[model samples]
Target chain A: MSADFATCYPLKRGRAHEVCGPGATYFAATCCNFSDKPVLWVCPSWQQEMLNPEGFAAYCDPARLLLARAASQIDLLAVSEEALRSGTVGLVVTEIFEPLSLTHGRRLQLAAEAGRTTGLILMPEGMGSNATETRWRCTPLAAGGDSTLQCWELIKNKSGTFTDWVTRWDAAARRIIVVSKTGERPRVARTAG
Target chain B: MRARPVDAPFALTAKESNTDRIQCLNTRAERAGLSRGMTLSDARALRPDLITRPADTPGDAGFLRVLARWAGRYCPWVGLEDADGLVLDVTGSTHLFGGETGLIADMRVRLMRAGLETRIGLGDSRGAAWALAHFGEGVAPPQQPLQALAELPVAALRLDPKLGIGLERLGLRSIADLTATPRAPLARRFGNGLLLRLDQALGTQPEPVVPLADPPQYGVRLTLPDPIGLLEDVTAGTARLLAQLCDKLKTRNQGARVLQLTLRRVDQGSQQVELRLARPMNDPVSILPLFERGLSGVEAGYGIDQLRLSATRVEDLAPTQIASAIRQSQTEDVAALITRIGTRIGLENVQRMLPADSHIPERSFILAAAAFSEAAPNWPPRRARPLRLFPPEPVAGAGPVPPVRFRWRRMALRVAAQSGPERLAPEWWLEDENWRRGLRDYWRVETAQGRRLWMFHTPQQPGWYVQGEFA
Candidate 1:
């Protein structure tokens, strides 16, 4: 794949990606917003209440979004795999708490490849490792002005070098803006009034 | 059939408090001077060795249902007529078996082989069939139901036995005796129900048989020569039945929405597993895995002798266009996958989002069943809202303008930037407990910690509450 294709974040066709940490779900939604195709969102039943269409409507067409609430982690995985393999859907997104094993990840990758669809797995903060092509840890940062800032750290990248970036999502323009890069330094926690 | 000499006297009895009463007696027992409704104690006293077994009402009812299902082979419409009899409407099917006599003979032989003694009755109406089954010795001509039923006893009309006795005592022993009697006086003397039954049987009144369910349009059955207990055998049988069922569905241009698989055990018991699909489907490959999941829970105890696959719910299946290979595979794969997961976790859990007609954030959109409801139409432009919203949580800070700082979830957050004071009034016509706070102004506040919180000020209560978060 070209560097431009790899650089475009969220998820890509015929590949499996994982977004972890506190703002994983937000990042997953942002990824869905970028896709032109319809999205299949599978989540635990408890998390169903958090799916705000108003937030999604900023980037994604609400009419094109489909939701599947799974009763358990196992069902979540199964439904995600099924949705991924279903070529009718352009993107498959799942919120999971359990760690995805290598074999399971590989299976999802193969299904996505066969269907020519994208699979995005959203995991809670501090989940175990998996064999995904790339794993991004996303955390929401305090907003400075009109745009919302999110810290994305590529913790695992099989196809390239690991990297991190501070990006701001411009809700009005419906695009991401790259902020100034910091060289391997911890972020300063500031309070505003 | 030759009548054999009496070897042993036997009767089926039901326990009534402290005594057992004979429900029914065989020919040998009746010949040995026993009668139905006779106390078992009295019958035993009359004959020292009068054999008896407790009545199995539930077993008999279950067997009746089984027979009803079996009768489906002869005709699409079969209903239970009383406890021991079944009514079959073989209107168009009779010709397939060479006529009514042939069908009756075939049923008799099969039922006898199943160890069940049966009596059949064919008529133009349900009441006629019922009367003929119990009274008439041979098949009655369709044109002359009244003539065929005339000589039979008044009990053939299915009147209460007490009422039958009342008519008999009045010199109305046979149906012919009542045919000539005046209707009003006979009804007045014997109650209106007697006349109703007589009219229904004589075809003057309409009596329709409400079948258990509409006959399945597509079904396939497999009877093994020898019972097989292995799971493989069950799956293999299901595959075969599904193939046959799919072929039948294809001919009708229909697809099955719900499938039922019945595994009849060798012990006269059966196990039924039902699969509900997320979408209508006719392909056997896609249907096989769903049955596999259900078959794991089924106990094929003592081996299964028969496997029957039936499409319980069928709908029209539009012919598929010759699409690209990828598109076709994708459609098939998704449908199959949905069916598999839906069968495991239930189809209701699979949902799709649809826009509602309300402006309230909570009521703006609804989750609908994916299998039934369609996606919402073009959604109206939405204002900026939080990615994640929670039940309104109270904030300690209060102010007419945007709060400079606030404490929520025990976290002290300073407002770095404030955006809106968009005034919104509560919907007056609706009774919403959450909106009881009256008019409010919502502001988008960006905190120093990099969290964008959606906080609102309820002017009525003059309190600040954090409602949602912007990603």
Candidate 2:
């Protein structure tokens, strides 16, 4: 209900311009406050074998985040691939390592629209933007005091709005809080991690 | 004493004043043209020939009481009317034994074997039973007392002479004539006594016979032609009784959940073994082993004459299909196996975990016998959990993070990769003893040994512990 509750938003570059894209894309950010509508995030790599620290951390972070948000009727039924295909989850956040079929993307798009759930995809850095609501590229941000940091991003939002926005990250808290509200020149801060 | 053939003529002759004219036996023989209370020699001198025998009062009474008990087989409820009489209220049950005639015929045959002469009365009242036993000449007449007792004079009632004369003078020659008189006049003149005889004969006055107390709620009874001695023999005997009990369950369309096996040893002091089943079952094969296990080492002092197996707690058990096709068939069959194991280990030793409708892992279950437990419903919605869960291990830590180094099961490991601070707060309503340790931060940590395990560190206790390992 308040400004601090808006925890995270799409990362910005130079100006807080809108995002546009050609191919189907996904954008996701964490909620800062409680609402009746529960927040859902999905990762296709949830079942992936954790070969390294980064990969293992990737699996562990979402689980912990979901557990933290278990306060608001946590429904974990969507972890199954079948559940993802059915769009049973309110929000989907899948890491795209390989190319997905167009049919898969269309089904996901229709399901997300029908179920009123946001679809978020983590894509590789090389692929240029295609038809999508929003597209974002993020790298680790500079740290702030007390486990807080910020991220740089390149986005393709179809709305042609808020393309270049900074992503603030709190690593110790596993939280990403947003600073900019309006589409304007973005100011950034750096801190030692 | 030598036993007499049951069909032989047995007289129930009692002394009568009018019988003085005829020489027979006992006091009547002496009184008839003989000396008063004279010796048999004197009685023989008067008649030249007189029959004589000692009175068999106790023998007859004892035999009659036995017959009364046997009569109980006809109806669940039966009572002894008097010294030489039995009162059977075959009101609704006459048809069950194939009407009064067949029942009387059956009783006659059984009695003949026991050496008794009987006069059966099919009546609606005790008064009618007495009247028929003493006065009725035929086997069974109509149930109507007036028509059945009409030919018999008023003296047939066994009343005193003055009372008979009064009834005769009142033109009440038979019970029918007496009942025909107005109740008001009879009460005024003959008093309630005459009316009582009338009402009792016609089946209305509450002439309730004291019925024997109901047979024990459940009886374990046995019948064996050859008595048994060895423990194995006793088990076989018990098996037979268990079969009989299952037959009874089938007839009732029910099954017994709890059973009592009684061993009536020839040496006296009976032994009782109680076997409990997880669920009510009527099949003899399933129940026999339960008792047999108890009987395997039974010490029959001398021998057991009979065996009795009775169902204590019975319930309806319908047939069901065995599910050998299910994925969990192996686990399901383990229940019957456990019950067999219970035979050696004692039934109480067998225990199973039943899931309770709760989210908390430890509190979500109760222990019961697998045999008796109801099948559990599908698992609740939650993250993929290990089939096995250990008691919460105390971990050393304060803030939520995967420990860089932690010791578990006496082994210290450096976290090769760390995953979570999945904070799990204890449910406030549930009183968890470890709640004092505060919230838990669980992490899936992969060790250098390539064994991926789930571990948690308690923020309150300031320690790290391994909870489970991923396969």
In order of the candidates, what TM-score does chain B achieve?
A: 0.54, 0.50
Candidate 2: stretches off by over 4 Å: A1-193, B1-217, B223-227, B319-335, B346-353, B395-398
The lDDT for every candidate, in the order shown, is: 0.79, 0.52
Which portions of model 1 miss their true places by more than 4 Å?
Answer: A1-13, A33-37, A85-88, A98-117, A141-144, A170-193, B1-216, B230-232, B318-333
TM-score for candidate 2, residues paired by index:
0.38
lDDT of 1 by residue, B113-204 (tens): 76555667787777787877777755768867877888889999888899988888999988889988999898777788988898888778
lDDT (Cα, tens digit) per residue for candidate 2, span B1-471: 127432221223334453422222333443555543344444556666555454466786777677678888777557876565777766677787688788888888887776555677666666766777777844335567667776677766556678889988878887767766789987898777777777777666768767666433444587677668787777777767777777778877787877888877776768878787756677777666656667766667777787777788888866545563473343323333344444444444344344466655445555454456553444334553322245656545445676666666676656566566577777888787756677777777765433345677776657676665442
Best by DockQ: 1
lDDT of 2 by residue, A1-193 (tens): 1132232242221111112221112123332112222223323323222111111131132211121011111111122122233332334444444444444455555555554445555455543225345455543222321221223344555444433444454434645555564443234422321
Q: What's the lDDT for residue A150 in model 2? A: 29
Every candidate's TM-score, chain A alone: 0.83, 0.49
